[model samples]
Target chain A: MELANIENLLEKYFEATTTVQEEQELQAYFSQDNVAPHLQEYQPMFQCFTNLKAETSTRNVPLQPRKNYLKWISVAAVFVLTTSLFINEWNKQRQAEEAFEYFKTTMALVSQSFNSGASHINYLTQFEETTNKIFKTENN
Target chain B: MKQADFLHTVLPFKDKLYRLAKRLLVSNEEAEDATQEVLMKLWSKKSKIEAYNNVEAFAMTMTKNYCLDKLKSKQAGNLKLVHSNYKDENTSLQKEVELRDSVSFVHEIMEELPEQQKIIIQLRDVEQYDFEEIAKVVDMNPTAIRVALSRARKYIRQELIKKHNYGVS
Candidate 1:
């Protein structure tokens, strides 16, 4: 009776009609120490399922857990980028201010030199007037 | 979902994903890589994971797709469907050898099966998945899944019995 039941279940198993419970029963029967000689060949097939199910990956699951870190890194990158840009603009502004200061100093130096030249022309005019007065005195 | 929560949820079934990859890719290293890749992909989609009714089924589908893609790529030259990892330390040497040979023969027979049937058998026979879960993973109706599974199971039985008889004779 047991053998008949197993044979029936085995047929349904191959036909893909066995329920999970019936399949488990078949697997249990085959896993025993003494399966009937005719059904012995089927032992390894069920055993293979058991063995394969036991096979777990020895390799570690490489989960980097870096998603939150990625968000933080992007934020830092933006912060760095904006700060560098602001610094560049500030540097350009300072450069322009320094250049204007140099220009103002240059203009002051040029004006001072022009004022000295004017004083020298005044001296020459005064000397010419003195010469004219001396000639008039001689004529008198 | 939070990453930690997602990890908690996925860690339990990580081995199942690995097994599916192993069944498809047939190499430990490749299977491991595929599992990791699939996990990362799921992590990327964790926000949208809530949209799915069953994350496990979704993950299984992703694993199946990823492994199939890997097999199709040129780098999978060594990824032949060979299951050589069977071992039995308690049995005598001769019996162990016989067991290993028969097991590997089963794998070779599986190799001859179409990729769909192979997956169906893997999910149904090995993983003990129900028709509905198998359908969700394969995107096939339950009836078609059952037919393909029946065909695959019968083919393996025929080939295995033939080999067993030849060995006995």
Candidate 2:
């Protein structure tokens, strides 16, 4: 704020002993329109620092987010789980259907053998009846 | 680290890295590339970055080293290291500098300084880094850094006063 103080700060600044706060005060003092004429020569340096500080890189920094991998992993996990579950269920249904087909074929074979045996039994019964009729006629 | 963590921690100071790279390399495009390279390096090592006590300081050191390497390998013929080579080195970068007035004049004067001195001034005066932090970035002790900074500040002052007097005359 005071000329004497700025001169003192400038002296400290050039000595590279000024604290950051003190350096900021000097910059603040110089940035105003009414710097002391004697110190006008020093103004550009501080202003240049300010201007350089304001200079930003217009280039883009590409930082692809890391979360995408996690998202894909979870999605992959869900897909595997559903696919396995579906396959498991389908496998069980197929096994049951195969077992039923085997049972039907086995039952049909057993019934076919039993039906042939029943037809032979029917012929034996008819022979027995014919024999009994002949015996009855002979006894009469 | 996570991208969000990196964005909060490292990405915030990218401009600081850019400014330091720009100051050292003296070309916006080179600085931008250097900054991107440094950032990509940091990201590659992001998992271990948390091990650092000061990530920003580490990033600054990386930028400084990267730009110096770039200058040595690619632009050794074109880049100036001292005032003697100032005229030859002052080509495309000089025309591209956007500062319009006395600030530009000071910038030119700064361009004449030794590379180390220019970096010290940029880190201390423009970036507001403390001496210890600057010591880490520049690989100099705090006392040596202070001395170099004082010399640079005084050099700028002498040049500015000379220019002012010449203008008045």
Highest lDDT scorer: 2
User: Going through the candidates in order, what is the number of backbone clashes in each?
Assistant: 0, 0
C-alpha lDDT of candidate 1 relative to the true structure: 0.84
TM-score of each: 0.75, 0.68
Model 1 chain B worst lDDT run, 10 consecutive residues:
B79-88
Model 2 agreement with the true structure over A23-104: per-residue lDDT tens digits: 9999999999999999988888999999999988788779764345887999999999999999999999999999999999
Model 2, residue pairs in steric clash: none
lDDT of 1 by residue, A1-140 (tens): 28999999998898899988888888889888889999887887887777778888787766565557878999999999999999999999999999999999999999999999888899899998998887777556
Looking at model 2, residue B47 earns an lDDT score of: 86
Candidate 2 Cα misplacement greater than 4 A, ranges? A65-140, B75-100
